[model samples]
Target: MDIAEINLQSRYVFRERISLMVLLCASSGRGFQVIPTSGMTLRSRSEHHLSNGDKYKDNVNALLLVATLVATVAFAAGFTVPGGFSSSPPNLGMAILANELDFCYFLLCNTLAMQCSVVAIVALIWAQLGDPELIHRAFHLALPSLFVALISMSAAFLFGVVATRRSHNNFLFNVVFNTVTAIFFHVMVLLLGPYVIPQLPGVPFL
Candidate 1:
């Protein structure tokens, strides 16, 4: 193998070993919550102030929209290119490139979007919490998002099981199906904000 391949294999091995150690440590249950120097506990419990400011909410909503769109595009496009490579023999290198890019792009974009959505939701809650006027209405609006997230997670699990069972080598289908399904669900969830959000009873829409 070339130097690059050797380096990659070694990195993979190291990561695998680290993963094993983490699993073992977690299973040990020694209650070792090593805090970071950056006041990790403070960060974990930090409270955000949600403003009813239209600009703030709009910005967050816009961010969610953009993130979801980008993620959807990346996931869909990545899946097709990578999978297309396998149909042509003697294109192993191209296939590998496509497959790797598909996995990485989908993973990165999807994760960023997911994280941003959570942050936005937390802001929404911070702003909307404690008004008896809004409990059920807020919940109803958020329920669709929750339901979609659950469905997406279920799809991911099902896909993993089915793909593993079939031993499918079609990276494009798997990646595309997984990424597109997830992004579509998330996007739908974000879009539900206006319809259900205004329904919040006690909480005034910022």
Candidate 2:
């Protein structure tokens, strides 16, 4: 063949190979488009297994109920002190142990317990009614509030026991009860306090 004809044939063969390559790449692209990507598949599976916030609602409600009961008892204890109320005019039927330090401590703890318990209950209720984000925030707040309420309630009970025993003139009994109460308080604070309180955001070290 002549040089011109040979050159024209080579050019035609090169064009055909280029066209075939382009067609193959286009077909491969379309094939890949037909299949779902890994990310899409993962997202779809995740949606199918999405968590429900109400899964723990029953547990939280039970805790709140118990806390409310403690609050009620604490509130009632404020009115019914260890010793009977005085009938004097100036005091106007106030508790006889009102001026005593242990009695005062009991009153302070009872008030704190009642307030914290109420706050915890409110937070839990709001968590049940609010959005997911709010629920998370409320739960964090409620846990700490409930912890404080429990500790304060326990302290109030201990103080009340001490005050009552002292008022009855039982010196040995008072010492024994106070020692046991102190041990119990220390155990509770050491074991549970650190675990519960530090989990809360912005909570200072105790």
Candidate 3:
């Protein structure tokens, strides 16, 4: 080939190689120059982030609903009481079972459930504000409070049932109460097992 033709071909090939290197560096993300992402990539990343945020909001909303429901139930139970209100002159407006140990326990547990549920509801409301730091803090507070509320509500239910029957020593009642207590504990252990038993080396965290 003529010298001019050879030089022209070499320049074209060199330009092609340089262009390929620039593309390779950009794709590998190790280039000296910072390459701006394409419009499609940025858009996809934004959509993915938005989807994740939406999912987080949905979860918070569901938890808020649960907390609100628990709070409402507990509050209503406090006013309704286990054995109704006394209409007598000496103990007017007091609970009929106020002196009973089971009724006292029921009231205590109901109070705890109501308080915890209120705390959870407040925290979850704050979580709805969309601040990442606040959301993290609110989640930590709300989840534990919600768990406590559930446990306390179960305890209150058990105590209320016992107080209503007025016979703790009945064989059938005893058997049913023990069975329910056992089931409650069993469910709790199962719920907590994944967090407790997955610390071993080859065990995956749930």
RMSD of each: 20.1, 22.8, 17.2
Candidate of highest lDDT: 3
Model 3 spans with C-alpha error above 4 angstroms: 1-52, 192-206
Worst 10 residues of 2 by lDDT: 34-43
Lowest summed lDDT across 10 adjacent residues in model 1 is found at 37-46
> On a 0 to 1 TM-score scale, where does candidate 3 land against the true structure?
0.67
- Separately for all candidates shown, the number of backbone clashes (residues 3 or more apart, or on different chains) is 4, 0, 0
Residue 176 in candidate 3 has what lDDT? 79
Whole-model lDDT per candidate: 0.39, 0.63, 0.66
lDDT of 1 by residue, 47-104 (tens): 2222222223443354345435444543554344333355466774364443443344
Candidate 3 residue-wise lDDT, 17-130, digit = tens? 334334433344532432111110111223333444343587689889999999999999999998899998799998899899989999999999999999999998888887
Q: Estimate each model's TM-score.
A: 0.26, 0.65, 0.67
Error of 1 at 78 (Å): 15
lDDT of 2 by residue, 1-206 (tens): 12222232212243443343343334444322211111111111122233444544665677679778978988888888787798988887888888889899999999999999999888888877635555556666677788788899998888887776645677887688768878988898776554344322222232
For model 1, give the RMSD to the true fold.
20.1
